[model samples]
Target chain A: MAKNTSLYEKHLAAGGKMVDFAGWEMPIHYGSQLEEHHQVRRDAGIFDVSHMTIIDLSGREVRGFLQKLLANDVNRLKKKGKALYSCMLNEKAGVIDDLIIYYMHDDWYRMIVNAATRNKDLTWIEKQAQNFEINIDERPDLAMLAVQGPNAREKAHKALGNKILAAQDLTPFFAVDCGEIFVGRTGYTGEDGYEIVLPSQQVPQLWDDLLTAGIEPIGLGARDTLRLEAGMNLYGQDMDESTNPLESGLAWTIAWQPEDRDFIGRGVLQKLRDSGPNNKLVGLVLQERGVLRNHQKVIVDGVGEGEITSGSFSPTLKCAIALARVPAQTEDQCHVEIRGEKRSAKVVKPSFVRFGQSCID
Target chain B: MSNVPDNLKYTKTHEWIRQESDGTLTIGVTDHAQGLLGDMVFVEVPDVDANFNSGDDCAVVESVKAASDVYCPVSGEITETNEALADTPEMVNNDPFGDGWLFKLRPTDPNEISTLLDANGYQEIIAEDSH
Candidate 1:
């Protein structure tokens, strides 16, 4: 039996179809996934993402602890409430997990990690924290809801009332605490939104309030399509412990400046940066009729073979698109083998669609 | 909810077959199958002249979520294939019973059609699978 989230009953009440995902019973969709996808793009849509783990780190040595733990530099987070996206790497420079770290105060920070990698991430964090004076507190009593879209911030502000208006002016990748609610101007859908973290006891009421505010309740089905269209990397599929961030199209998240930040995987990352990675992640758009899917073979002329990690029909683009890891030398033109038949595809930089607009040429 | 046309016979695998007056058969996936597969991304149907035995894998329907094999409920020779699906696969997701008809076949033995389940029997199969 899979564990259910705090919103499971609320989801069922709203006619959600539950599916087992990462040892948790989650709502795949309420009714039409396409409608939900468009709703998040055009209007407001909310998702119950309490299944993800939230950890709060607080101590005088927290900055030092994070500088040594994460692949990216924590010193860059100078402004209070600012957030940084980084990857926790192993000794071999393989990506353990990618997470968002919020600098709440001088000595306190909050980290949100993927739900599936909760145990391993905690274990790794604990082993490293043993040498520092940091306190690792897992906030299991908190529930999270992500409301996203072009109108998401307005709708969220309406639901939160005047007290949360401070979050309205929050810059992107920043968080603000209003009373008991922590609202972050961040989301996975590549849209303007707020990811609200509040006590579990207040979640049911907040969900109802959001519904009353006309925010459509979305599910995991639409979430997958939206994230794929946004070109956001799913931790397990896009990069895992076996793959490095450089090959995963996440080199930007790595901070190599200041010359001597001795992060755990700095040596291997430096070596890989000097030599270059074998494969690179790119976005593929099918030129002809056909949908590129995961594990589908990609053939690039003069380069080598690669496979799509995430692919789907972009509702906004009205065509098939994909994220594939191919030979670093591969160029724009490629072919994807769909059902043993080669279909023409064009490779480009990612962020194919964002904020209800086309990001690709 | 879409109704299963009374004239067509369905299989446990959610395939509907229509028997023509001249003993020919036209096969397509059911609305239930398309609903389960979500968006149809690609499809692989057999060649027009290919012959298959009963219960053989003759076609494939790949969606963004999964890929499923469409089995032959009755042995037959493929007489015609829907070429339009190669360009617009969403036709299967939009109209699985009508425009999405996969292929036409001339049954090796016309009597094989009687072995397929009727609408009520196919409904029972869906009910059992849900549990």
Candidate 2:
């Protein structure tokens, strides 16, 4: 049997097509995925992200524990409610999971990891924390909602009522606490929005209030296209236990400034950083009428070969775009083998769209 | 429940066929198939005059998330395809029985029609499959 979120009944009432997602029965779409995708870019949309795993860590050595567990430095987050995105790596420099860490204080911090990788991520985090004086507790009682789009903030504020005032003026990458609710000014979609975490029991009311506010309910379908168009990497698809951050277009997330910070897999990453990653993740725009799909072969002429990690039709760009792992020397153009035919594609920066605008040139 | 027009015939693989006055069979994925596929982004229609054996892979339909192969329901030579789908593949979701027809083919074995499922039989197939 699949797990159900607090909004499962609401999803059924709203005509959502329920499907199994990471062991949870989630909505794939309400009526049409394309329309939902467009709605987020044009207006605002809400998604039930409660299935994502949230873990809380508190102790005298919380800061030190995170510094050693995550590849990104938490020392930069001096202010409370500041969030950092980092890839939790294994000893071989392979990515275990990519997640967001929200700083509440030196002793108390919250981390949200992917749903599919919950078991392993927890085991890994717990194993790393045994030596240090820390308490790692999973917050299964919490529910998370991501309200994203150009007008996402206003609509979310309207749905959330007075509690949103604390998050109203939040800058990007910052989070705020209003009693029992926590709002992070960050999202997977490249749109301005808030990822609100609250008590699971209180989510149904918020979900209904957001619907009454005219914010469309986005399903997992549109959630994927939106993220792909934004050039964001999906955990299992873009990178996994077999891949590392340097080759996954996540080199920017690594904080190597303080060489003394001996995080997990630091030595391997340091060697790769100096030698440079041989394969790079890049964006591909189909020069013809075709949909780019994952695992498709990509051939870089006279250079090398590669494969698409995440590919989809970008409703925002009105064309097919994909993120491909190709030989780092590839430039300007390549070809994707779709079916039995080789189609031309243009290579560009991994980010295809951002802030409701096409970032492609 | 999916709409299964009484006038058409369906295959076990979720394709609907309608025999035109010219004896050419028009084929497309069933309504339930399109609904399962969500929204369509692109369709690769088979070329005119292309010949295929029954159950042979002919064209492709891609939704935003994945691609599915469209199989030829019966052996025939392709007569026409829905060119409009090249620009607007959502026709598959909007009118899977009408404007969304994938291709038209002249049947080589007209007797094969008797082996195809009627609306009721096709409905049962979808129902049992879901169970």
Candidate 3:
């Protein structure tokens, strides 16, 4: 049997189609997934993200440990509540997981990782911490909700009540501790929103309150479509332990400056940088009526073949879009094999939609 | 919460059949089928004039979450297919019983549909599946 989140009963009450995801019983959709996707784009929507893993690190050597463990530089987060997105890589430069790290205090940092990667990530982090004196506290008692859209901030403010003022001045990628809840101005969808991390026991009340506040309850189906429209990569689908950040459209997250910082995969990354990565991840927009899907072969006419990592019917764009890993020499026009027939697609930057607007022409 | 018309015949695989006076029959996925599949993104109907026996996979309905095959409930030759679904597949979810009819077929044996289940029988299947 799959484990249930704190809001599982509430989701069932609201007509969510329950499905098993990452060993957890989660909602795939409440009713119409297309409507839910439009809800987030046009107005406010809430997502139950309690399945994501949260770990807190507190120690004198926390910053040093992070600098060596993550591909991104944590030193850039000088101000409190600042957050940085980084990828944890193995010694071979293969990506273990991509996560957001928030600097809470001089000795404390909070990181939220993907749900499916929790056990492996914890094991890897614990093994690495043996050399440094740090405490890794996995906060299973926390339940998360992401309220996102064009008017999400204002609606979240209204729903949160007393914590409104403290969260008002928060900018993107910043977080604030509002007594019992931690509100971060971050989201997976390409929309403005707040991700609230609070005690698990209090989650059902918050979910009901958000629903009463006129926020629609979105599920994992729309969440996937929304994130894919934003060109965000899903951990296991887009890249995994066998894939590296350089080839996964996450090269920008790797900070290679200050030459001697020496992050975990710095050596292999530097070598790849010097020799150049053979494959690059790009966006694909189907010019025809077919829906693009994962594992489809991407045939760049003159160049070599590639494969689609994540693909979906973009509700916002009214068409299909995909993220594909193609040869470095691949250009604008390519053909994707759908069911046996080769269909033409246009290659562009990885983003298709952001802030409810189409990014590609 | 799905509508099951009393006059139609149903299949264990979730398809519905409506016999026509012109010796042809219309077929579509039931309301319960569309409800379970969520929003329909694409529907791949079998080509007109294709022949199939009962239980043969004849069409596909794809939602955002998954793709499911629609099997033929009775042996027939496909006379027509709903082409409008190529652009607006949501019709299946919006009006599954009427405008969302997937295909039409001329029956090889008009009596073959008697072996299929009635609405009450289909409801029983759905109710059991729900549990």
Candidate 4:
């Protein structure tokens, strides 16, 4: 049986179509997914992201432990409630998971990881913490909700009341805590929003209150399209334990400053960085009528073969877009084998849309 | 509850057929199929005048989540396709029975239509599948 989020009953009552995702029974859509996508792009929408794992690290040596655990430099987060996006890699420099870490104090930090990689991430973190003096605590007692879009802050503030003011004043990539709830000015949809983590028992009431405040409940379907349009990578698809961040269009997330910091996978990543990656991830826009799909073979005329990692009809762009791993030298245009026919597609930067606007020319 | 019009015929794959007065038949995916597929983004209709065997996958309906094949219910020659759906595939979700009709076919055997599931039979199939 799939696990249920704290708001599962409320989702069913609201007519959400529930599907098994990452072992959790989560809503795929309340109704038309296209409309939900438009809602997040044009107005405001909320997503039940409680399935995402939240882990808090505390101890005198927490800061030092994180410095060696993440690919990004947590030392850059000097201010309290500042968040950093980083990829945790294995010894081979292959990405294990991408997560967001929020620094609350010198000895206290919070991390949110992908739902599908919960077990693997926790195990890895625990194993790495054995040598350190930090306490690894997975906080399943908390539930998360992401309110996103252009008017997201306004609506969330209306529902959450003055408690959200601290979050409202927060800059991008920053966070604030109000009592038991922690609100972060961050999201995966490339829209201005807040991700609030609260006590698990309060989720259903908050969900209902948000609905009363006119915030539409968006599901996983639109979430995928929105993230893809924003050029965000999905774990297990864009990259995994066997794929390094360099080839997955995530080289920017790696922090190389303080050269002698000696983080895990630093040696392998340094070597790969000097030589460069063989295959690169690029965006493809289908020039024809068909939809792009994962695993479709991409053929570059003189370069070589590549494969699509994530593909879908972008609701915001009204066109088929995809992320594909191709030869580092491939550029401009390529042919994608859809069904059995080779259809032409335009190659561009991996992002097609952002902040409700088309980013691709 | 699903919309199973008593006047139409249905296949297990969730397509409905209506025999026209001129021995031709109009076909479209059932409302249940469209609901299951969510919003349609692109639809590939069979070419006019193409011949197909019964149960052949002749067309495709794609939504944001997945792509599903639309099968021909009976052996027939395609006569017309709803070209408007190429630009406005959402018709399949908005009006699966009326403006969303996929294609018109001149049946090879009009009697074959009688062998399809009736409204009651189709509802039973949908109920069983849901379970």
Candidate 5:
């Protein structure tokens, strides 16, 4: 049997197509996926992402523990409610999971990790925290809802009421706490949004309230397209324990400052940085009429071969785009194999679209 | 939902076949298949004039999430293919029973058609599989 979220009944009531995802029954879509995708881009849409695991770390040694545990330094969080995106790596510098860590106080911090890697991440955190006076608690009583798009913040404010809405001024990548609710100005979609984490019991009402506020209930289908458009990497698809963040287009998430600080994978990362990786993750935009997809072969003239990690049709751009791991020396133009035919593509930096604007050149 | 026309036969795999008066059979993926697939991004239909056996993998449909194989229900020689699907694959999602018909076949053994499930039987299969 699959585990059900607090919003399972609500999702079924909304005519969702439920499927087993990471042991949880999740809505893949509510009717037309394309419509849901467009809804998040043009208006407002909400997703029940409670299946993601949230872990709270608390203790006097929390900051020191995090500085050594995460690739990104949490000390950079000067203000409360600031969030940092980082990759938890193994001893070999392979990415175990990409997560968002929220700084709440000197003694308390919150981390949200992928549902599929919950057990492994928990074990890894526990093993690392054994020497430090840190307490790690998984908060299963919390349910998360991501309300995204141009009208997302407004709809969330309307649903959450005025008291909680006062935190609406939070800058991007920041979070605010209002009693039991944690509101974050963050989302996978390249649009304005708020991801609210609240008690499980209050989830259904909040979902209903958001819907009443004219926010369409979206599902995982649109979530994938939205994140792809944002050039965000999906765990297990774009990178895993076998890949390092340096070659997965996540180098920016790594905080290399404070040279004395030693994170779990620092040594291996330093070596890799010194030696340079053979392949680098790059963005590819198809110049022809074809959809780029994962595992497709990429050919670069006078360079080595590579494979696409994530690919899809960009509804905003009305063209096919992808993230591929190509040879480090690969240049501007490359060919992606689509259905046994070579399709021309342009290699560019990622963050294809952001906040209603095109970021690709 | 459109009614399954009485003249066509359906397979458990969600493909429908229509036998024309000229003894040729037109086949297509059902609307239910397209809906489940979400959105159509790429399609790979077998070449015309190719021979296929029943249950053979004859076409490939790639949606945004994953790829699926469309099997041939009846053994036959492919006489014509739906060229329009090359450019407008969403036709399969919109009108699977009509313009989205994948290919036409001249059955090597016309008796194979008798073993296929009718609309009622196909509906029962879909309901059973839903569980």
Candidate 6:
């Protein structure tokens, strides 16, 4: 049986159509997914993301341990409540998982990882921590809600009540400890919002509060489209333990500077970087009527064939968009094999929509 | 909470059928089917005059997350296709029963309709599947 989040009943009450996702009974959509996508772009929307694993690492050697464990450098997070998005890679330089770590104190840090990758990620992190003295504390007692949109911040402020002042001045990519709830000004959707982590008992109340504050609950269906539009890669679909970050449109997330910092998979990644990646992750925009879908074959004439990692119709852009891994030489245009028929698509930067605006031409 | 009209018949795969006055039949997906698929970004309506056997994949319903095949509920020749859906696919989601009718067909054998499901039977199937 799939596990239920604290707000499962609330989801049912809101007419959510529940489905199993990553061993959790989650809502795929409450009603119309396109409308939910629009809601997050134009107004406020909330999501029950409590299935994500939260690990709190605290020890004197946490910083050093994180530096060696993550592909991205944690040294950049100088201020308190600052967050860093990094990928944990294997010895072969393949991504184990991508996660966000918040620096709360010198000896304490909070990490949030994907729900589907929780078990593997915990095993990997624990295995790596054997050489150092640090605590890997997974917080299952917490529930998370992502409140997102252009109007999300103000609505979240209204719902949070006493914690308003603490979160009011928070900058993007920053977080603040608001006594009972930890508010991070970050989200998967290409919108301004807060991902609040609080006690499981507080979740239902907060969900109702957000609803009362005029924020509607969005589901996983819209979440996937929103993230795909933002050019964010999903684990398992985009890349897995077999694909490296260089070929996965995540080279920017890799901290290659300060050559002395020998993080996990550094040597292999550096070699791959020197030789250059043969396949590249690029964006595809279908100008016509068809919707782009995952696993579709991307044919670039004279160049090697590629596969779509994540693809969907952009509710904001009103067209089909996808992230595909194709040959480095592939440019300008490509043909996607849909139902055995080759359809033309324009190749551009992976990001198609951000902040309710079209990032594509 | 999905609507199932009592006047029309349904198939196990969630397609709805309305017997027209001309003896031809209008076929579209049910509200339950549309609800399951989410928003209809595109609908690949079967070509007019196309003939199909029962259980054949006649048309496709593409949503944001997935593409599902709309099977031939009853063997028929496609008499007409919904042209409006080409420009406004959301008709499948907005008004699935009326304007969203995918095609009109003249059945090979009219008695084949009795073998399919009624609205109550279809609701039972949906309710069972939800569990």
Q: What is the DockQ of each candidate?
A: 0.45, 0.82, 0.67, 0.90, 0.52, 0.76
Chain B TM-score, structure 5? 0.94
Stretches of candidate 4 above 4 Å error?
none
Tens-digit lDDT string for candidate 5 (B1-131): 53566677999988899999999999998877887787776677889999999999898776766677889999999999998988787788788788888899999999999999998888787788779
Interface residue Cα RMSD of candidate 4 after superposition? 0.5
Q: Which residue pairs overlap in candidate 5's backbone?
A: none
Give me the runs in candidate 1 sitting further than 4 Å from their true place: B1-6, B41-52, B79-96
Show model 5 residue runs off by greater than 4 Å.
B1-3, B45-58, B72-80, B106-116, B120-128
Question: Once superposed on the true structure, which residue ranges of model 6 sit more than 4 Å away at CA?
Answer: B108-115, B118-124
Q: C-alpha displacement of A209 in model 1, angstroms? A: 1.1
Interface RMSD for every prediction, one decimal? Answer: 2.4, 0.9, 1.2, 0.5, 1.9, 1.1
Model 3 Cα lDDT, one tens digit per residue, B100-124: 9999999899888789999999999
Model 6 B-chain TM: 0.98
Q: Write the per-residue lDDT of candidate 2 for residues A1-361, one digit (tens) a residue.
A: 9999999999999999999999999999999899999999999999999999999999999999899999999998988889999999999999999999999877889999999999999989989988899999999999999999998899888877797789878999999888899999999889999999999999999999988988999999999999999999999999998989999999999999797999999999899889988999999999998988899999999999999999899988989999999998999999999887899999999888898899988
TM-scores of all predicted structures? 0.94, 0.98, 0.95, 0.98, 0.93, 0.96
Q: Write the per-residue lDDT of candidate 4 for residues B3-108, one digit (tens) a residue.
A: 8899999999999999899889999999999988989999999999999999999999999999999999999999999999999999999999999999999999
Candidate 3, residue A291: lDDT:
80
lDDT of each residue in A1-361, candidate 5, tens digit only: 8999999999999999999999999999988777898899889999999999999999999899999999999989999999999999999999999999999888889999999999999999999999999899999999999999999888778777874765768999999988888999988998999888999999998888899999999989889888988999999989999999989999998888999989999999999999998888999999987788889999997887899999988777867899999999998999999878899999998778887677877
Where does model 4 sit among the CAPRI classes? high
Residue B19 lDDT (model 6): 94
Order by DockQ, highest first: 4, 2, 6, 3, 5, 1
DockQ of model 1, rounded to 2 decimals: 0.45
Every candidate's TM-score, chain A alone: 0.98, 0.99, 0.99, 0.99, 0.98, 0.99
